[model samples]
Target: MTPLLSWLTAVLVGVAPPPPGRTRELSTRDRELLAVCQTDQFRRVDVRIASIVEWRERRGRPYRTIPPDASLPEGHIAFTFDDGPDERATPKIRALLAACGVYGHFFIPGTRVGGPKARWAIAELKGLLAEGHIIGTHSATHPSFTRGVVTSRDRRRELDRGREALEATLDIHPVLFRLPYGEGHWDSEVLFEISRAGLVDLHWNITSDDAKDKAPKEPGFQGLTADEVLARIERSLDFSRRPGERLGHGVLVVHDTNYRIAALLPTLLNRLVTRGYTFVRFVGPLVEGRDAEEDTGVPRRD
Candidate 1:
């Protein structure tokens, strides 16, 4: 039987045998086969993928610049974090975001959700979702999306598998994505792969430059202090402003991989609030509510 026909048969039988050693985690090909099998169940897949392709073909700008009026809050600014669900730092960060009544977009890799021995990250992910923060797929294993050596097929797997893993764990599929390391070129193949997965690329206009602190360099490397990082963020916000420019939206990128930024999150949020900026959740594509149970053989209990 053809792949589609086989997958359809499996779906009808209600027992599609998973690949060897991957009973929980669905591979990219598995998702494709399933997508082909239950076209009605995934009717939105083609439309969403087409939207991504059209956006890529047009070289669509970041999601912030075109915020729908209804989604905008007074003094809007989007706070996005990457490379997380950090065990030591995420709970603290979640508390901080909660105290401030602001939502952050956490772009996470599937690997961080933990394995058999440890399962704290999955709890943290669930907590983040429970607290009303938006989660976006960072990648399956946080690979560099812009490196020329990474093939398009691998990139698609990263996007598709990551989404599958997250949806299985959180029970909600995410439609927002960011390449690992925030690396991308205009109209790159990586972008097309992202578009193929029915996700919107949410890039940041401002970076906290916190990675410098995380890089344990030799003495005199001169990394920015938390204050300096906040200053850089301030400058970025200023640069985006024009004389008589309306309070348009912008996305700020920060990391939760280390404690430096997490420790200083209060300072950053305070500055923004004091400056009349309202923290707003990202308004983009999302999977509405939970779906049916999925056995993500990847073992992390939530």
Candidate 2:
């Protein structure tokens, strides 16, 4: 979903990049295809995948193995931002996270680190490290990991490239990966590749649905007042509830490109806090690549 941030990232051949390529004039057909590909319906393929997963568990094939509460308190929360390290709003969020004294995870683009729009992303990541926030890979170029859709070999190369780039730029080997669009058959082929790369695939408990949205076209939202986008995103938090199931902690996912994200942060954080949720970063062995996450949260009773 955050494909641009992931794909347009820095390459490992020493950050001194080639002269930028000339912009190609895109046809109307190209633009239409781009919009359709980025829509919610296109991404719902992942939802179907998840539903099938939940169903498999119904048939006695458990997919997740949620961790026991090991001296952890109830209502521990974590705020994670994906498709980041932008010179734009990412650092702002990091600063806010720092003020809250909560350690969150930043899933950054490996190649984009030293690039123009996100060169500061590397510095921000360094600051995050100093402040105890964990760093994870969002993929080398943010491409699909689907086997037939994108050759498995290419997926490995891209993932490994990302891992290497993140380590080189940020000086820390990334331990977690949020698959591009959160798509992939996590139990088989994708898992095999992730395991070999020594990284765990991390997905969100709550998504802000920021990627699928296109900015307003008329007058470019020049004088819009208040935080409409944030209000919509706040509604996403409602999806985190699981009735009688102990949902464990929540990791909220949002993009750096959202309009008024900074303005909405205080209100959202305030609401989550009012609900007794405190931010807590992932620290399982799976994230460290010792073993993959058998389960990321508590499953429902059949």
Candidate 3:
């Protein structure tokens, strides 16, 4: 083999091979191209340090980024529940959170948490907020903007209804919104609606994906056998986080209304508490106290 090629191979093998099917690794030719564009490593690190210093100076502290603030620290994971205020299930979700001495951000359907339903559940939500839990909106009905869930007009109506329901119930409305099914087809109208509603798009970094797996009678989940669901939730947590390390920040996307989640919440929260994480609600930057401006169109209450 040519000495030049041998050296190149050694350098490539020295660090670490990229994972299979991952295209992010530096290809030999691409890396060689970079040699012409190379900047000093120490200089790069210095630039990063300076950038962080300047950012901290202006923003006080940046959110959801590496080299987190000394105050916020790193490795803290936030728990956020979606599509809830489930009369039967939400109480249990709340109780588990209380027992753990940690609270989560709850994304509620405005209809469920409003009107007569609000009469019953809003009190519980108030207790949650009182205890530092956060509430965000998850649309008025559990409709989806995805092509599979419902028609476009129906989807718009659902969001519009949620906005009204939230305003009627909470009075302040919600400023945070998450898509149904943990994913959405983004477009100009979606962007316009989000902006007009004055809502921040709240989403998850970790989802159990158990909502799609409702077949408890099947192998993975079982009827009344909540352990299976609990186990999967645990596994999701494990896969999403590193143990004994400071994560500084992460958002765990979990469900409340799903019966399987009834068993899952307690165990995961307990495990998380034991891990030295203080459960903070994964609220976006536009919470009520964070704002002093007029309503933007999005419902602010969950």
Candidate 4:
């Protein structure tokens, strides 16, 4: 192995630190060496992977569920939007949620807020906060950390930069993070980075599959229609619930960047309400000590 690959292999196996004078940046040659490590031919290393939820539960910090009430017959259901702060779709989604009198958790990519559309993105994020929605980091540039292509330094940078950008801009310290593409949820390295950053990683048990791209000649040529998305969500809910359980609880994920989902959000929300599902916010280490019901309440916007 070359010195760089050897060093990386050692690092992956928990044996060594970065070589001297190579801590801050990778040289062109070093980049090529790293690329070699990312190839499919490269042998995958075995590391202790851990599920964040199980880890939290083991520590007695099990995520709290929003129980059913008289008005909402079904148990808790939290809505999470990823890969967003879109110029068009996001605002419409916010408006739709506002109309439905429910709040959502939006996981935004740091680059979107700090990039060229920083002004609009910042304003949009602020608006979401003002309207009582919760926001979390989705990482800077949304890289897939479990792919072996991401270095330790890259992981730290992704987590820290994304968090710092939001804190600096919003003057709020976010305690929640969701992995890009929902990858690395159980990777020890990824979990360590998240814990080191003092952020709890949130993973969804239910998904709308709204982010999925439709194949050529698919019914909804661009994306899945509202009915299709609803069907997928219902099926997931059915599978997750017990045989005799009347209500189900889970975090449902969608993308705010998808206009189809945004536009049809009301239909989904109404259907969910009619089906006795109560919209709730994620609660646990992410919002320690805060009641999910209180968190779900309307925010007092100035």
| Whole-model Cα lDDT of every candidate shown, in order | 0.59, 0.53, 0.51, 0.63
* Sort order, lDDT high to low: 4, 1, 2, 3
Q: Which runs of model 1 end up more than 4 angstroms from their true locations?
A: 1-74, 116-118, 214-223, 246-248, 283-302
Per-residue alpha-carbon lDDT of model 1 for 215-271, expressed as tens digits? 343121124676777787777777666457644346788877655565467666655
TM-score of each: 0.67, 0.64, 0.60, 0.68
Maximum-TM-score candidate: 4
What lDDT score goes with residue 217 in model 4? 31
Better of 1 and 3 by TM-score: 1
Poorly placed runs, candidate 3 (over 4 Å): 1-74, 114-118, 148-157, 185-189, 213-225, 241-249, 283-302
1-302: candidate 3 lDDT, tens digit per residue = 87546644655666322112111233344333333222221010001111221111213422222121212223456666777765545665665555445556677777677566668676666666666566677777776666544554665666667666756665545555666665462343443454345454556555566566545333222233467656665565555555565443455676765645655555555455445454444333443344322232222443
Span of 10 residues, lowest total lDDT, candidate 1: 41-50
Candidate 1 contains a number of clashing pairs equal to 2
After the best TM-score superposition of candidate 3, give how far the Cα of residue 152 lies from its true spot, in angstroms: 8.0
Tell me which residue pairs clash in candidate 4: none
lDDT of 1: 0.59
- Per residue, candidate 4 scores C-alpha lDDT tens digits across 36-89 of 333332221111112123333324433311211111223567788898877546
